[model samples]
Target: MDFLHSSWLIGLAIFVVVFVLAQSMFFLVKAIQRAKVLKFQTSDIKRVMVSTMIFSIAPSVAILLGLLALSKVLGVIIPWIRLSVLGAVTYELPATINVVEGVFGQSIGQRITDPVLFVTVVWVMTLGVLPPMIIIPLFLKRIQGRVKNIRKKDQRWGEIFMNAMFLGMISAFLGYVIAPRTDAVTGESYVSLLAIFTLLTSAGLMAIIGVIITKFNKEWLKNYAVSFSMLGAMALAILYAMLGVR
Candidate 1:
């Protein structure tokens, strides 16, 4: 863990955080200035700022949970930096688990104390996300143009195409959630019921929240729905674990 939490790493993490904060502040200031130039009401701007701040809290709670999960093995600094930056929990946890189990053949249940293993995990996680950065800049406009053309030609198929893409991405995670694995010690295969149940629970909660938002006009829940679903599913996971579900 010493390597994971070395002074140099801590300093680098702190530097990254401070740089992100400064970048955010710069953009915020610029936005406010532009808003003023555009003759937006001061009160309206303030209200928007307050509402955004409130809405951010729920998502931050989910990120905090991810940080805790990763911190247990990777230590606090790396996870903190990752989550605080562009990294999403959806991508970070799975990438870490994949590298630990698939690449290194090690259990995430144990801390990554080896500096080489730690570096490898960090590099894999970092590199895995790079394709998106490159792809978006190079091809996103072309993709959007094609989507627009499809929508112009046939709106229904356009929507179906978009939904198909989304579901295809989701299926990748679903595969991970429901996949079976052999216990390293026992050599017996078993699926992770806890993950499957948690996924179902979260999906159920999201569906309920969607119903409330649509049928009952609880629009504000839209901001908090994902957070609530994630937290509820996590709570159910703990209960499942206590009941000996693996």
Candidate 2:
């Protein structure tokens, strides 16, 4: 039996995907019903749903790109299940690489052949990300309650705290993009100029979109502004690469 294309694995993936879709539909219906009960206009609910769906496209495409890379190494079923569940490519790629190189002394460029090695990689990937799953289930309610208490005590401070957290995360990624690197042979300082360019381009495009939406009152553009900016930035990155920016 070919583990990579096993019938059972494909069936499992299909089942999981179907379950996820069903869960999403269930929640969406419930939310719409509750919104109606709260006297929300039907048009407002539809607009919210449409905007949310548009906002999700770019990120979902990014995930699909990750799935394509993972599929080359681990085959389709495993990556399909992982990405459909809690596994983002950020975590999944590193976990797979770490186990493949550290434990098996193999490269991910090659297909995983041995069942034992494959199983070990799967176990490592699963265990590495399992802590968050456990923690969320056990502590999420308490954490939410504490956050609510803080907000109740000082609403302004609570908003500031959340903004700070978001800024910290963004700063970390920005730092990574601009961090210095040395050429392997030339000993010259290098940085990911393409990444910086892409980041700035995306930011500029988003800012422009915000200005246009505010100044001209282009309300419909708000639904797709982020997606447009992201794709535009990605295209600029490719152009930057072609022009030897990095």
Candidate 3:
């Protein structure tokens, strides 16, 4: 929404619409795709979705608590600390927009007058409601079929779970601080459509690990998963942060 760029309200409007669609649309499609590909049952995904949502959301909780905790405690250590650097994803929306326009205004609009809409549209395509709308379900389906029956002896699966959760939390935390945001004159403060893409990009690492867990030995993926996710997420956050969103 061009209206969102000029104001936070409009961005909220776009976010509301996009959020509902993203959470639901991809839930089923991803489930179906993963089930078919993995030869699992579509109906079984109900539990998978529930489980993944629970596991993935944990980091979000941690992020919130971490921010509050960090603010009160760490703020004492580094008196100049600002929320964005140490806060959750939602807090950084304004910074994301401001940095993008201030830093890349010319090149962004060089080819067109409505660079706002141009970026919004492209971002939605690349990062909007598409990835989760297509991935979460697949991931859940994999969890349902391949991971359900593993016993404690399967330390391999345990390591895989730990790795996936670690990466998911890191992404979620950064996403809170640096997610795409837009506001409009209509009084809506919203995250951008690009959030979907960012989520997808971050989730890709988890997806890959999940696949490996299902077909390969966990020890290999485990030893390398955290290091890889850390580097990848850092690069992604910097790239997007510099990209500065509309």
Candidate 4:
């Protein structure tokens, strides 16, 4: 059996994907039913669902790009299963590379030919991300309960806390993008100005959208603004690359 494209691997991938769809459908149906019980209009519920679907498309496409990148080395099955489950490309790629380079002294660009190395890579990938799954299940409810209590105590502070968390995440990503890197083409040390520009472009567009939505009461833009901003920022990144911003 081919380790990369075996029939059993494909079958397992299918099963996992199907399970994800099934679980989402279950929650969707429950949400709609609960909305109805709470006297939400059908149109409102449908609008929310449609808006969510629209908002998800851009991020889903980004994930697909990540899947494609990883597919070059790991093939389709492992990345497909990982991305379909809880693993993001940001985490999975680094975890795989760390194990491969640290253990085998090889780059991910090189195809992993040894079965033992492949198994080791898989184990590292699995174990590296396992803590989150265990911790979430064991403590997520308690954490959420505390958050809810705080929110109930002071709604303004709750909002501030959420905003702070979001800003923290954004700052982390910004720091990552602006970190120094060696130019692939020139082999010179430089910061990723293109990524920083792209990040700022996306944020600017989002802010503009927010202002437009608030000032003009353009409620419809709320659903699609994020997708538009992301795509716009990506387009700007491409143009910046063409203009030698990298």
Q: Which regions of candidate 4 deviate over 4 angstroms? A: 38-40
| Candidate 1 lDDT over residue span 33-75, tens digit each | 9999999988777867776776577578878999999998899
lDDT of 3 by residue, 1-246 (tens): 332234454454456556666877888787678788997765455546665554455465556564454333222211112221232334333333343455445332223235564345334323433556567766978765665556365878877887897999987776685564556566666765455545566568767876787788674455445445544654576677678742
Best by TM-score: 2
- lDDT for each residue of candidate 4 in 2-71, tens digit (9 for 90 to 100): 6887899899999999999999999999989999999999988887788778778878998999999988
TM-score, model 1 to reference: 0.60
TM-score of each: 0.60, 0.87, 0.26, 0.86
Return the lDDT, model 1, position 204: 99
RMSD of each: 5.6, 2.6, 17.7, 2.4
List candidate 3 segments past 4 Å from native: 1-75, 78-188, 213-218, 223-227, 244-246
Arranged by TM-score, best first: 2, 4, 1, 3
lDDT of 2 by residue, 34-64 (tens): 9999999998888788877877887898899
Give all candidates' CA lDDT scores: 0.88, 0.89, 0.51, 0.88
> How high is the lDDT of residue 24 in model 1?
97
Winner on lDDT between 2 and 3 is: 2
